[model samples]
Target: MAARLRRRLALVALVRVFKPGTPGVGRRLAAVPRLIAATLRGQYDGAARLATMAVAAIYLVSPFDFIGVAIFLIVGVLGDAALVTWLAGALMDETERFLEWERGSGRRPVA
Candidate 1:
């Protein structure tokens, strides 16, 4: 029981060491959004991006391409992140406009 507890503790410690806010992980976390934005904006103008997207699309359309499925999983994560960012930006813009309108009306108490 002691040995199992120690092993589990060690595994937890190892996972914490590699957690997202750790020093070395910052670059990778930052890169994910950059990659997603680049892909969405068509900035990755080479064979690699094309190949990745092609495989992803194939996997999306068909259910049997194992390799394509893997590729799609990775790209889909990035795409989802990009979509979230895009939607958040739009939401912020709308919120700002609403706030501006409220301020201009001089009827609501400012918080």
Candidate 2:
């Protein structure tokens, strides 16, 4: 559904990622390497989801062009725009989780 897709985009989350706080964009970006290391070492539990988001990000800048723009500029760009929004929001959330995992604080796993 279009409404669900729009919610997935979460442009506001992209903006909020940069807001000053414990999980700001600067801190999030800083943790990426550690996150990857932890995942590869089997210390983190969200590897699959992280890989999916990484692929989405790589595809966004990928020259192969998932949605060719030559004939459908608007549609093609919109597709990338939507992917960007989704990736940004997902990154914010994933990084927040990683940060909590790092400090051993914040939300606990649902029981």
Candidate 3:
């Protein structure tokens, strides 16, 4: 059973490396949006949180002091998430402003 599981995992890794746009890539990429949306909505689930925890674990295992690595990981995750959220909000605001300006100019016909 363990051997079968290892083989399956190895096959998945190989496929992900050789077939960049496979369904697995799409699913993992899709998970990012779902993760962020869940975070924003305060509905984080085990899978999404596990993804974050994995990142934190990587940070912990890196060549750094354990306590400092953990603190850095916490801060990094919080800062990165906040930055992304803020950037998205800024992008939406900019897009809305551009649309408003376009409407005011009356250069384009409404569809």
After superposition on all C-alphas, the RMSD of every candidate to the true structure, in Å, is 18.8, 7.8, 16.7
Q: Model 1, residue 105: what's the lDDT?
A: 46
How would you encode candidate 1's per-residue C-alpha lDDT over 15-75 as one tens digit per residue? Answer: 4435664323333334444344444665322235335444645554565544544679877
Tens-digit lDDT string for candidate 2 (15-107): 767677647777778888777887898877768868999899777777766557556899988878888778878777777767677667342
The list of candidate 1 runs beyond 4 A from truth reads 1-71, 109-111
The TM-score leader among the candidates is 2
Clashing pairs in 1: none
Model 2 spans with C-alpha error above 4 angstroms: 1-12, 18-20, 105-111
Better of 2 and 3 by TM-score: 2
**TM-scores, all models, native as reference:** 0.33, 0.72, 0.35
- Best prediction by lDDT: 2
Supply every candidate's count of residue pairs whose N, Cα or C atoms clash at under 3 angstroms.
0, 0, 0
lDDT of 2 at 40: 90
On lDDT, who's better, 1 or 3? Answer: 3
